[model samples]
Target: MLRRPQGNLSYVSGVTDDPLRFVTLSQALDETVAAHGTRAAAIFSSEREVMSWKELQRQSDDVAAALLGLGLQRGDRIGMCSANRREWLLAQFGAARIGAVLVNLNPAYRSTELEFALNKVRCRVLILARSTAAGNHLGMLRVLAPELDQPGAKPVLESRRLPHLRHVIVLGEGLVPARAERFSDFLRRGSANGKRRLAALAAALDPDDAVSLQFTGGTTGAPKAVALSHFSIVNNARFAARAMQVGEGDKLCIAGPLHQSLGLVLGVLTCVTTGATMVFPGPDFDPLRTLDAVSRHRCTVLHGGPALFQALLDHPELPEYDTSSLRTGIVAGAPCPADMLERAVQLLCLDELTVVYGMTEAGPVTFQTDVDDPLELRVATVGRVHPNIEVKIVDPDDRIVPVGRLGELCVRGYSVMRGYWEDAKRTRDAFDETGWMRTGDLATLDADGYCRIVGRVRDRVLRGNRLVCPEAVEALIRRHPKVQDAQVFGVPEVKPEGRSDAKPEGNRGEDLCAWIVLAPGAAASAEEIRAFCRAKGEAEQVPGPVRFVAAFPVTASGKAQKFAMRASMVREMKAREIKTA
Candidate 1:
């Protein structure tokens, strides 16, 4: 009984007249603390650390003072290369206090990716963890800039490679390199006088100033730096807080990496803007840990991608966990598959599970389902346009398509990012003449204003929530001596069920597949190629299955037809009919 609109226009604006307050993140934090100082602000369950609003304010002030003592100034880029932890939150709010842009570095990034992020943003101060489960972060940093490990190293690293970097502040206690300062010592250097100065600095700050930079996977090449302002993210977080009906003492469990917008903006800032307690299950997403944290903290809300929710539901001990406290949660970054949403509602105690849709360029989210909406709407669509935002579905000719017609989705609002940092050409190309940010997602708007994302118009691969650029991975693979040419694409995969009677489950997710034209007579196995990619690239970027191809199907323009490759792989896999179940 769906009705279709008669008009040719396909634009829609959010109906709410909710005021978007203009305030810096530091100001927002101050206001929250003033209102709820005694309330719990953050809890790191794994570390057994808890902080009230007052404690968080004091620690963040000290961290800001330490950064100022390190000679960082307003508008300076400060990079945080660590996983989720108490210190990460400290750096996040601390940088906001002084107007320093906090650059989010993915924890999974290797030496090459780390080098690119550090140098690309011209990070003056770099904050990092000693190491992560993946590998030694400091060791990799030394590999990128070996000057740190060498004797008689200058107090300030004089690397021609990273000329803008002036100081390295290592987080947590460990063997501190002589070239870097320990986080504890750095914090001790801050005095009472510096805290007084921080007040004046906060007073002079403007909401429009660029306060953070997030890297997004590129369509043309490597990832680009997305610059966002305090104004943009604050308003987005406020809208989200309102949407989720967040309130004081409402514990929110977060399992995603803090580097992503989901964790930092939606999870952290939403709690700060509202008066909710931010809970971190662990440094990374662990289904059991997340469930445990929710049960122990009596968390009312949880936020993560679909994969995490699925993992939680699929856990063998799911029935044993007391998740009755969970009333609402957000499942984003991927589609909520068949039966998954219902299962989440029934088993996880998430009766008000909502689905959100957005990209990094749009300050993360512009569409989300209401808590009271029907389960069908919550799973089938990305919900209506958010308040204070405008959306349109346009044809290739820049004209608005009729409702229910598939077209590229474009958005216009305060939530839109300022621009890609320092890339004028790309920035200009991202927006239309009328200032609409082209989202590159093919979608259709129904007469009721609900949007259904169909597919992507751009040539990119999405493995879970991670945006993987085939060209970027291909470029890395091509560097192999035996690989003459390479193309990476997403191939639909199926996972075998453990039971003999169960049918093989279609993952509805993708696996990275690489088709390479090897050098004459060169032979390579899938393991060898994966290992090579693992050493040189990110684990996510490494192809799961390697195929040796003599040549690729190309169009008349000599462009590799990735769609053809995907189709061929799908057909080949289906023909094998391996007993995955």
Candidate 2:
């Protein structure tokens, strides 16, 4: 329930009878294992691997012991770059078991991104897959650290580029680098003595200790590392599990990337807290495999972003599989359209589908609709504040706004991140004077405390003195009969003929561009969409350019990359200018 202390102010706190859990992740996992030892903890459908709770506990202990054998200490950072797989979970829990922080590195990252993240966090150890559907992850590491190519090099890597990176553990069967150790060999390094050390470390672990570093989506700039504590994520998962009504025997098919908090905290940790079965459809999200897993395993819950759900809904072979087993799930990582939610309910049999709103910094979830909420409430709003969380909407001056007025969303509570990892300046800027973490999202709160996200503050486009919100435009465009999906962003304004690059008195220096993905067998021109938007939306909300594409460039977690789209549009505009000259 939401409590409003200041009448008409956009401030609300979630009041719940359930108290927050004070245990570390390792303790939470142990408690679940004690109760559901023989139950299936995880099932990798594509790999044909199933691990019971007892087995998961045993393997994670071995992982912890191996890290101890390698001379890793508490508060050290261990990076893992891989797709969704069993090793990901093993490494996650293993790192927590020894009080080490796990830095989740996206498998899609190349040399530059990978190097920056590892060096930023000062990672001492990295565990990565040899390859993924994205590309050769190991090859990128080799390019970043040429020392790995040297024959007869020691197990510890010594590189100038990645100075803090001392060890690289590679998974999958391949020609292992001389300086890098194979994952299987690394696990064997665990012994009875190392196990004793791991047990001792686990016993001394604190719930407030940082256990994970999640990088932001980097849509606007370089990604900031958000540090999360054991207490924050463990309680977050427990509360989320309660909201979805997850139980011990429930099976969840989680398709989001493990690098993001959506997958690791909400998907993996939720299962650990609830004693539910975590099901992976494949190493990476495959709609066919997901459908098959839901039918084959009778998965009770499903989780994915809007794009993933759309892929599943639009797949040609969707009707061939049974999705009736799916009852509840989360639609997050991007703004979800009402039509998509309705379609998912009718087609995917997700009667209790809820929309969640959060960022990587807020332990990944601050607001989520209840499973029993009406369809209109579920589709229109991101729901009320999460349990044990305080939320408020503030204007530019950081003053609280009136209810139902648009402003920046600020959050404070146990679920808020400890801070941006090791960056004091950014961390200081993330919160207000009273310690409310600024969420950087434009939103409005109703009297009932339901939050309606308008868009990101940085995402608003300035065009000829008029500010246009892309989310509003995109929502209007998606209502068109021919459009299946749409992403709106701002590109550099093309100067009129005979005008210089200098900004004129009234110029805003940006133009709105819309990328549209048409419905199957649908054909529409750019003018058609612009006209439709002009008819239904305000003048400032109508995009100038509309480009129809098969799909939008998205992050691994399925959020549309508006920055990438803007870059592509700018490049095309430059090409056109050169041609005209």
Candidate 3:
């Protein structure tokens, strides 16, 4: 039902006659359990465990009762800092059941980022793994809250740095610090009275109540906590589930981290609405583990970013396992190259692999390709807007651009987030006066309503007098047979001596740089890549300096960190200049 009423204008709306479900996530889970009690609700492949809908309900109920017994009340903020695990899922639903807002903390975050997030949201309780690849999370907590290490420390945390934090729950079998509670013991503390209270709280919960605080990718600045209400995410998941044609029989292998909206909202919530089986390949993304999960569980759906799929396709043991069970999936969180999409379709057997375009603020999904869409549409554009959403491409002056014209994408609909947590100024700045949430993504709307994302507005590289779109350049570079992936960005050009007319510090022009990850067993020089781009066309499109890399820096959600790449390149260039001088 996507339509462009005025063919000359860039405004489009996804019209749907179906009424949106107005229920809390707790209510949604209850309905699904009633309908599919015996069906498998979750499968932790790494742990060799499976839980049916009925079992899932019982475990989540235990989690809710435990939190209630700890004196957590409605609207209290509880933080979860861990990789994908059964406990993370339980905490997500449990907090929602008691109307507590779960603040998703990235497991990759270090002490500085972690401290800021907890204090910013005023988290009363935090649940974390003992350790991760990042480091010892429990150790970091001790550093931040030295009171935890004091003699005769009580279970309640008292830290001057993190004043709002009162309780710390550690996951893992071991002797926890004196001020922390073990997850096992914490879960066992639930009482019959607590269970009754949980039920009463769930019954009184409203669909509009905020259920989770998902942090943004923070590519531009400090990560903002985006508050999402049950009404927003549930409907968003329902629309996405409908688009993917997910059902109770389908098993989904989720490679994305549960801390992000991609995992919790799209992956988990979508399954809750459709009764599909949710599969966690492992705590962190491992191609081998993911493939084994798909082959072993016969997972019908898969979800991850472009980098994840690229790793799977490039794995040496790819042919050793069967991926034919992957009939449908979602490739999002970054710009997807056409070559990568084609490879996923042929190698992973994801014929219905869709491309989703959204940010954390848009309930994580605003536009998504349909299952039956053409390969070209799925590869080239993030398809039409989701039902009950409105989209428009606007110029700098806020005028709607014409179809086929590039402009900033803006959206307004039920799926948009309430706002950044406790940041009124940022929330006000995120939308227009009329309530349209500015996406900050440069994109073009086709006559058919397909959206081709150009790149980030700030990510455009200005070389000489021309502005270069890094996404376009990266797409061209990825077509090289020797290249597996490419990230293109602007590096500040060193100012020549006595150049008084040079642009100011922030506005200085930049030279195009390309960081390429070579295809396995393939070798190529920087000059060869430049020559390849030169032969293709457009001298302006060719990158000035090409550097080979094993991989590009990426966020937890798997989006390439172009700003980080740009800064690193600038530093390298400056060092070179100093050595030459």
- Per-residue CA lDDT of candidate 1, range 372-448, in tens? 88999987898878888888888889888988887889999899999999999999999988889999888888888
- Scored against the true structure, residue 242 in model 3 reaches a CA lDDT of 88
- Model 3 residue runs over 4 Å out of place are 480-484, 491-510, 515-529, 545-560, 565-581
Expressed as tens digits, the lDDT of each residue in 1-581 for candidate 3 is 34553668999988677678889999999999999999899999999999998988889899999998889999999999998999998898999999999999988886888998999999999999999776789999999999887656458888999999988999989998888899999998799988888778899998989999988877756788999999999999999888899999899888888887779988999999999999999898999999999999999999888888999999999999999888998998887878889999999999999899988899979899999999999988899888989999999899999899989999998889999999999999999889999988999998888988898888888777887888889888988999978988888866555455656657867878999999899999988999999998578889877899998887654557887888888888778757655
Question: Which candidate would rank higher by lDDT, 1 or 2?
Answer: 2
On the 0 to 100 scale, the lDDT of residue 393 in model 2 is 93
Q: How far is candidate 3 from the true structure (C-alpha RMSD, Å)?
A: 2.8
In model 2, the worst 10-residue window by lDDT is 499-508
User: How high a TM-score does candidate 2 get?
Assistant: 0.93
Kindly state the number of residue pairs that clash in model 3.
0
